[model samples]
Target: SASETPGKAAVGEENIVKLQHVQDTREFFIEVLEYLPGGNLYQYLEQKEMLDEYTACRVSLRILKALDHLHARRLLHRDVRLQQFILAEPGDPESCKLADLWCLASLPRKKNFMVEEGRPCDLLTAAPEVVKQGEFSAKSDVWAAGCVIFELLHGHPPFGGTGKALVQRICCGEPEFSELGTATGGLSDNAIDLLRWMLQREPGQRPSVHECLKHAWFEGYNVEKPSKQVWQVEKLIRHVKLWGKPPHSRRNLPASNLLASKRGIVTPGFCTYMGATSVDIDFEPCQMCQGVLEVIGKSEEQQSLGSRVWYWVTKCVLSLWGREENPKQIQLKVCVKPGSPWVELGSCTLDDSTALEASIKIDKPIRYVRISLRGNLGGHFGIAVRKVAFYGYQVRQIPIALHLENLKFLRGSRLHTHAQDIHPKEVNARVHKSLQSSLRVGRRIEGTGAKYRVYEDICSGSPHITTAAETPRLKFPQGVVLIGAVLGLRYVSEVPSKESAPPRLRIQIVKEVNAGGDHERRMKKTLLFATEDLTPPSWKANEVLGNGYVDYPVMFSTGIRANGDDRLHLEILFQNFSGTAHVPADLGLSFFYVPELQSPSTSEDEGLWAGCIQSVQSATVESVSLGMRKLLSIWFPFHFPRSFPCDFLLLRFYILQPYILVSLT
Candidate 1:
C-alpha cells in the first residue's frame, strides 16, 4: 500500500505491491458495501498489544459472514489478507469490512486472469493451489481466512518470511499453531480445529464460509451490525507505529546487524522457496570455521519456498602459505532451480524440502560431470538444484601389469640288421662235409665257381662222379676255418693240400641238388660272391672227419698245412641275394651237412663200406652282413634257395692272409 503511493518505502514495499493488469471491471464501493471502515486489520493487530480470545472470535465471525455473502453472489475474492480489512469506526472493536476489490474475479468469468495481475499478495495467507498452480476458487479464500485468523491470534501472519518461503510452506502443509507458543494462546479449540480443516489437502474438503460461521468457536459471537463511528486514520497510524512492525522484522534486525558488521567471520547463509511457509537451515559444523552458526526460518518448522529455492554457505580458504593475512571469507550462494525432473533427493536445507541429498560416495573421482534424473521426486512437479562441491581431498589414478612362460625340445634311434645264426652245429657239419668230399672227388659243381647260372640248370654242371656205389669215403681234418660268412652255405670239410703232406681244409657254402627236372626246379646255378680271395689256406672245413665223408661228394675244397700244432682261425660272412624285380613269396636260410653212419656189412668178410648222404638242418637267420652292402632276408619257417657273395680267410702262426675258396656245387 505504501509503494502504491510512492514514498521512502518500507523494508518490503517493492515486494508488497507488484501488480498484474487485466480487463477492467469497476464496481462502485458505496453501492455494494454495507459496512463503513475498520481501518487495516494488519495495522490494527500491530498496534494492539494482544487480542483477547473473545475479541478475536468476534472479528473472525464478521469476516466469515462477509465471505458467505460474497460466495452466495458467486463472487470470488482471489486476494484476501489483513491489509484488505478496514475499520468501520475509530476505536470500534467489532467494526471491520473487507476492501481491496482489485483482486476479485467473477465466478462465470471462465478465466480468472485478474488474480495473477493484482497485488503481490502475502503468500502466508494464500492457498496451496495459489502458490503451486496459481489456481484460485472460493475454497482457496477459506484457506486465506484461516491464515487471517492465525495472524489475528499470533499478532503476525501465520507463516511469515520471504514471500517465496511462505508459498512453499503453504503448498506442502499448514504451519502448526503450537509452534507459535504464547502468540497462539487463548484461541478456542473449535477455532483452531476449523482453521486446520480449511487448510485440508483437497479444496473440496474445506468447509464453506457459511459452514465456518456456524462453528462452535463463534457460539456467542454475533454477525449483526455494530455502531458505526468515523475513525481518524492518523491516530490509528500513530498507534500502529508505537507497536512497531511484525516480530520477524525486530528479531531479524539483530542478525542483520551482526552479519553486516562482523569482519573476521563468514556470515551464515539463507534460502527462500516459492510455496513453503518456513526456510529450514542447519548451520552446525559451520562451513567456514569450527564454531557453529544459527539458522532461522519463516516458521519454526523452517518451511521452504515451493519454487526456486535458494541455498547459501560461507567458508574461508587460505590462499597463501607463509603470509599472516586476515582470513578471507566468501559467500557461496546457489538457487534451487525448480522443475519436475530435479526433485529433491536430500540436501543441507534443514526444512528438507527442495534441498535434497543422499549419502553418496563416489568410489573414484570424476570430472566434467553431467547428472541426469534417476528416480521419482515424491509426487511433486518441478526439479530443484542448489549447490555441490567436494570438501576434503584431491583425487588420483593407478596402474596394472602382466607376465608369461616359455617352451623346450624332445628325444628318439634309427633301424638296423645284424646276422644271428639259427643252426650253428648243422652249419659247421655242412662245411666239413663239403670240404672233405670236394677234395676226395675233385669235381666241379655248377654253383661252385660260376658267377651266374640259369634257373633250371643249377646242378647240371656238377660232376656225376659218384653214384650211390661210388660215393666218397673220406677222412676229414679235426678242425675247420670259415673266413667269410655267407648266406646259403650248406656243407664244408678239410682235406690234404697237394703242396704238402699235412691236411688242408676248405670252407664251403652248399645247397642240395634237387631231383626234379628242368620244369619243376627253381634254383639258379649262381654263387653270389662277397669276396675274391681264392687262395688255398683260406678254404677250410669242420673238424668232424666222419661228418665230412657222410654226404655226397663236396664239389670244391681247400685247406692250409703249416708248422706243427699251429692252429688256424676261420671267419665267414653270408648274405641273401635275389633279383630286385622278383620279390620271392618266401625266403630262408638252408644248411647242408653230412652225418657219419656204420658200414652196412660185417667188416672181415666184405670190404668195409662207408655209406654217406647229404642232409639239411633247418636254419633261419633274419639278419646277415654282406661284404659291403648289408642285406636282410627272412629265414624262419621255410628255406629260400638264393645265392649271395662268399669269402674265406685263414689266420695261422704269425701270418694273417685271405683263405682261398675252392668252388663246389
Candidate 2:
C-alpha cells in the first residue's frame, strides 16, 4: 500500500509508518502496519523529563518533516502532539515516525473551515482560534506543533490553568517566553522569535509547515553535541583547577564583562570583599524589573496572575585565592526563590597562592546564591573570594535623578518675581475664583488654587491663562514605589527686587481621596522653614546666608497610597516671609507625584519588605533656610515594600545644579 501511494517519493516516506497488510472479514476489517520497538515520544519525555537544546532541535526537525509530509497531500493531522509520534529506534531520539492518523481530515476548499461545536480535543495543544471560534485549519496544526516544541524544552506547556479561565487565557493571552533556550542550551532569541511566528493568534500570519522548516533556528543546527557545552557549569569550573603552584601575581583574570566583575555586589559601585567564615550574596532589588498580572475582578477570591517569576542567575564568574598549603573546597548552592529548596551547584577547590578566576556557566537560572567553604579548621583560612559575577536576563531600573526634566512640577513658567503687584486680598480673591472653576470642571487641588491652575493649564489646556515651564517627564515601565528623597539648597538674605523681604521655604504633602464616582476630597499637611536665625556678632550679613545644610524630619504615622484612581503629591514653594507665620507670599512653586504606600500582609513579610530589623528610625532637626537664593537640592529615602508589585523606584529632579537622590534600603 505504501508503494502504491502517489507523491510518496516527494514527501519523505521514512518519516511515516509503512502500511503493510490488510484483511477483510465478514464482521470487521483488520489492517497491519510496520512495528517499531521504541515507544512513543511522550513516553521518552516522561523518562527524560526534558531534552537539551541539541536534542530538542533534532527532535523538532524530524517532527516538522513528518508534518510537512502530511501537509503536502493537503491532509491535516488534527491531533499533533508528542503522544502521536513513535520513535523508530530505542536509543535514537531523532528517529520519530508519525503514527495515529485516524483524526486526519482533508483540507476544505472553502476559505473558512469550522469544526463542530463542543468537540473534545487536546485543550493544551489547541490553537486560539479553535478554542474561541471553533475554526480549524492547517495552521492550527502548526500551533499544536509549536506547543509540543515548547513543552520539550521547558518541561511544561506554554499555558497552564483549568476550566473557563484557561479558555479565556488561550483566547486572549500571549505565552510567557521569558524563559527559553539557545544553541548552547541557554536563552535563545531566535527560538523565541520563531515561536512568536508559529503561535500567532491570526492563522494567516503564521508560517506554513515549509516556511517553519526554513527558519533560522534550523540553520547551522546539527544533532552532534557541542565540543564544549557552555551550559554545563561543572565542566566550565573544572578546567580552572590547578593542584600545583600558583601564578606570579593575580594577573590572569577572566573576562571583565561578567555580571559581578567591575560592578559591586549590591549596586554598580565599589565593594570591599573581606575573607570571612561564611557569606551570602543577594542582588539589589532596584536592579531588577518586576510585573504583576492584571486582576480580572475586584473580589478577593478572584484568580489573577501573580508577580512575574524570575530566575536571574544563569552564568557566574568567581574570583578566588589561587595558592595555599591546604586548599579549601567551596560549596556553591542556589535558591530559586524564597522558601524554595536550595539546589547544589557543585563544589570547587580554591587556594590562596595565585588569583583564581573560574567562570561557571549554569544551565538554569537561580535567584539566591549561597557559598560555603570546607576544609577550614581553627586558625586556617576560610573561603577567600575576591569578586563574583553573574550573567542572565536582567531588566535594569531607571535612575529617577538622571531624568529630572520629565517631572510635572519642573515643567512650567519661570518663577513669578512680580509678587509685589498683587495684594494679599486680590490673591485670596483669585484663589477663590480658581477653586470655584476647578470644582465646576471636576479638578482637585489641595492648597494654593492659583498654583494648581497653572499646573492644570500646562498639563491640560484650560480656560485659565497661567504661565508654566516645560520640563522632561520620566516614563516608568510600570507602577513604581517612592522610597525617599534628599534636597540641597543655597540661601540668600535679601532679594534683588524686594528691598526688605527675606526668603523662606515651604513643603506641603497633599493626598487626594476618591469616594467612588464623582465625589473626591483633599487633605493637606504643611511644614515651613525660615532663615531668620540670628547672625553671630562677628559674622557679616552676607556670611550668615552663604552656605548651610539643614535636616528636615518628615513624619507620618499612617501609610499613604498613590495610584491611578487616587494620588499623593509633594509640593515645595519658595516665598517671602510676611512678618508673621500666618501667610507668606508665593514666589515659585513646584510639585510631583509620590509612590503609593501599602501595609504588608504579614509581620514576617513586613520584615522582608522593610529590608531592616528596626521598625522605624526617627530623628528631630529644626529647619532653617538661608533665604533661598537659587540653589535647591532634594534627597528623599522612600520606604519600599517587598510584597508590593513595584520593581524599582526613583526620585530625581534638578534646579541650578540642585539634584535629588531617592535611596531604597
Top of the candidates by TM-score: 2
lDDT of 2 by residue, 1-665 (tens): 43223223223467877666555566754545679889988788776555666677778888889888877787777778888888889956788888765455666665535475576678778898888766777799999999888877655676656666667667888774532434323535667777789888889999999999998877745446444211221211111111112222222322121122210011121111232344333432112112222222222221121222332244666655453412256566653223223456666665444646655555333334554444532223333445454444321111222112223432232222111233333444543321221111113344545322220111111111111222222233234332222222222222233333433454444455555657665454433223232112232222221221121221111122223222444444434332311111112111112222121000011111121111111221112111211112121111212211122222211111111111111
By lDDT, the best candidate is 2
Per-prediction tally of clashes: 92, 34
Task: Give per-model CA RMSD.
Answer: 54.1, 23.4
Q: What is the lDDT of residue 110 in candidate 1?
A: 62
What would the TM-scores of all predictions be?
A: 0.30, 0.36
Cα lDDT listed for each candidate: 0.32, 0.43
